[model samples]
Target: MGELFNRFHATRRNRRRFWLSILIFSSTVLFLFLVFFVKRHEQKSLSYSQVEPDSCVRLHEVSGVYRIRSERNRGRIWFATAQGLYELDTLRNQWQRFGPDQGLGSDKVYDVAFIDEIPWAVTRRGCNRYNAKRGRFEMVAPGSKLDRAPLILIEEMEPEGVFFGVDGGELYRLASLQAKPERIPIPDGNDDARITCLKKIGEMLYIGIENGWLYAYDPRNGSFHRYVFGRPLSPHAYLWDVVLFKGNLWVATSENGLYRQEQTGEDTLKPVKGFPAKGAFAFALEEDGFWCGTPFGLWRYHARQDAWIQFVHPREKQPTDFQVLTLFNEKDRLWFGSLENGCGYLNKRNLEWVTAFPSLSRPNAAALAADDSLVWVGFGYQGGFTNAYSSDALQKIKAYEASDDILEQSIQCFTLSNHRLFYGGYEGFGYLNMATGEYDHYSARRFPEIADITDIAVSPSQGLYYLAGAFGVVAYYADKDSLASFSETRRYRTTALYAEGDTLWAGTLSHGVLVIDRKSGQLLARMDGVSSRVMGLFGRPDNPDLLLATKEKGCYRLQKSTLRMESVDIPDKVLPGGCQQYENNIMTAKGMGNLFWVGTRFRGAVVYDENIRQWKRVTSQQGLLGNQIRAFAQSDRYIWIGTYGGVTRFHKPYLSRLLDIVL
Candidate 1:
């Protein structure tokens, strides 16, 4: 009986083993099938993202302009815009922009001048001379005496010389292109005084000072004379412009209106009648009379009637609100640069207004975000509206202006979470519910500490959002509808934030980067030595490593395992014509599959392909709207670039294919 029992137990054990083997085989097959299905689905989706070659890159819209420079002899007009320098092609009716990528010293051109038929531009950093043969702006006196100084104005002197004014009220004269700039001593120079404008009439050079004084320098005799309006020592006055109109010296001032003085007489300065009492910024000489630009509008001084007539916009019905900053007169038109309204031209014969180049309305593109269906772009200060574009139809764009509900007009950064769009701007943080089409805003009025929102990061697993700005870092609990700050984030000037698994990275203005343990709210690591001001941190879409972008240190990659930072090598060809230092001027960096994209404040955008180890650049020459890239976003099919000029879309697959063919 014992033997029979053992036989029955063995048979039952064998049957149990067979059933376990069958179960294991079925589970393995199911897992394999799921993996295959997912891979195939990804391939199908990628194929759908491919676009045609003709639609590889397209410009959607243009931003408003700030200043205008005309070269009537060449039949070209140069626009000194926030984007860069744009030359209007009258024959084609198109605008061509030049930036660092196009070989300019910098993209932020404050003033432009043509001396000896050569175009020269003065940037906040230094001065650049345009090379017509090479079609690029070459830096003048780089790392020399003229370097590392903020140039405010540039004007041609008598005979064949140019004068440049530094922000510190020092004046330098360039006798020729090959000659070194010689310092021209100011009589009783005040270090606090700044040179605003310079004009030359006959043998005299008229220099306008922000201290409300106009200096008349006789270049031939080396004599200096100062002219003052109001009190001789009035500190409230500011001289904006100096010009010669109808053999009379005309001066525009910030405190007083317009002043006119005869060339030969008692030289008594008299204020022009029927002009704005304040904020007279610029002037232009006309045949019949003179043109004055003020805060109110453009005014024409009729010589025959001695009466003033204000030119109003046909559409607005009110006087043109363009705060004209500079003026240029052509044979038949008057060009005026505005403080916010881009630039305008008036027909001299009919006294009609012409909207030459409409302002981008929003000058600085601050933040960019995109999903599968739409792209959202935010602007910086004075940027009147936020722009949106449909991913499927990029030509269709919409603008969101500030209203009673939307208090913030300047957006600094944006993020997407829970099917909603969240933005941080001049005032505070806000969110738009995509499903409900509802808008909700929060500002310093509610949370006084949260002002000047610069960057944002969302934690999906923890159901929280992180905001970084002037006040450091703050946490928003979506469930609790509350904002709080952690001890680790205090006392740090954080400008940007990024979230990863179990860790949050905070980019500071001067302290480098701070890595914190999200769960414990404790600082884990402080990554220094990358840059003084870290602009952004991004993770590679295909890899676990991280990239850090900075203001002057270029870009660096942080290894996930070792956390060691390594500098990424940028191709020299990406920025030709002595613009190699511009690699460190990176503002934003993003990664996709095997390509890394970088955006700069001046040098447009660059894409590095990891597969073939190549770099490709896009600027105005390559059909981009502008070269000053403020923000960048990538969808599955397209890469969106937010520039000072407008929003540009690039088809990823087509670009990749084109690069392959070129390489």
Candidate 2:
């Protein structure tokens, strides 16, 4: 009996060891899975890069209005925009913004409708309804069927619900905010199923789909009738907008222009004659007339004379209010939203003055320069305009006169040193006396070789200004007021410039950096092995390695001691579905403290901390107007980023928490 007891104890001990081995194996597998998930999900290498809202302000107001509606008794005006929904208190004149933070399904809200004074929005994320008391949006849909919802229309008749259209030709109705979405069958006609606009005419519902097709549905009969615009539509043709005016139908096509149907007409839509633009974007109905928003501007149709009156933003031209996208009118106040300039309404008789002003908008911020007291934004392309604003309030300081000759050209690059703002662009290079607020511009006539300047650098060591562009590298001595051209780099296409000691680094299109002596204006040696297409360069007196930014290629650490360039490894991603097109590009880079901030053409920013040798990436998801970054300007407390869409300012103190993720 003793022997048997001992044997049983031994067996039990063995069994315990087996179970422990199994547990250890399972834990190992689980740990591996978690590691893979975190690396894949968050795109984490060293740390993460999502920042809180307080850290950044996307000042560009990415507000492209798609639809505008007024809440009559509520004294509220609702606008569906590209970024989010905006609610304006017409009485109190206050604006309340509703975005993803406010529980919105998505930021891309295309249409918003109010039923029973409650706002219902259709966004790329799906259907959402506002809970006013809670001040947030709640999702109201079955699963994710309403995902990619773009157009919404209210139903006043029986069923008393809202009809929303999804991108995949699927339409759903919500009988009540709390109820599930019911799918409504839609007739197929166009190849593209994405719905663009929706309008309700009596019991018949008009649905405009992409691909230039319109469908009219009668709820009573459960039937759909398809109508088409004249054939041979452009390859990019699509129905942008539709409206009912004077018992007739009017529709706008993306590329084929505007179309209209007579009160008693055929299934085919005829092109609107005398319409200036080939593409009309939006329409708003008035008492007897209708307003058409087009690429040319806003046109108001007069019933009496059957003519159209044009109204555009006075100070801007083609790139300004010329491309009117959305319009809405309330009595004498005509609200209009352009492609860039947020949204504003025009009073009666405001149309005439628009003719005089011609509505050319402020030039887009191509290059940015800032100091303690002021920030100067320079525009290029359609003639340059230097706008100076107070750093405290960001209010424009009308310091330059309209007739200034410098304002007539585009400013491609700017170099601010010693209160002298040196600008270079299509005309050549010029200097604006920031202290005196005086404009002293130089045209191509001043120096023919400096024309079409791409980049300019000021040599603090030698106090000489160097130019690199289409005409190649040139030297200008401010003290002597002399210009010298380097014949060796004369035909070479230079892109960027950096001054180090007495040597000037000029990045070329394909030849690499042209290291030249600032005093003699002579080319030293071409630094090869780096990118043939270098963009921007950042260096410091203490740092041994110079950070070289290149187009499409990641940055490199060029050792000034050895004159060798080495590539740095950039992770494939930092977030899920993020930076798919990231080529590890560092289009422009600037260094401050231990951090180097670089902007990409696609991604908003990528920050590197030298202390930890780690990096973080940020994009539009982190509050950027647009991802195509062009320029950057930094102050003590704020860092400004200029993109094709607009400028973004980062509050440095608050931003540190998000960017300081490495160590």
Which candidate number maximizes TM-score? Answer: 2
C-alpha RMSD of each candidate structure in angstroms: 25.3, 13.5
Candidate 1: C-alpha RMSD to true structure equals: 25.3
Model 2: how far residue 17 lies from native, Å: 44
Number of the top-ranking candidate, with lDDT as the measure: 1
In the range 167-237, model 1's lDDT, one tens digit per residue, is: 87888888876788888888776544788767777778888776666788887767888775533424766
Residue 412 lDDT in model 1? 76
lDDT of 1 at 8: 98
494-530: candidate 2 lDDT, tens digit per residue: 8888777877777887777777876677888888775
Off by over 4 Å in 1: 1-67, 158-160, 230-234, 314-320, 348-352, 358-639, 643-663
Evaluate all candidate structures by whole-model CA lDDT and list the values in order.
Answer: 0.70, 0.69
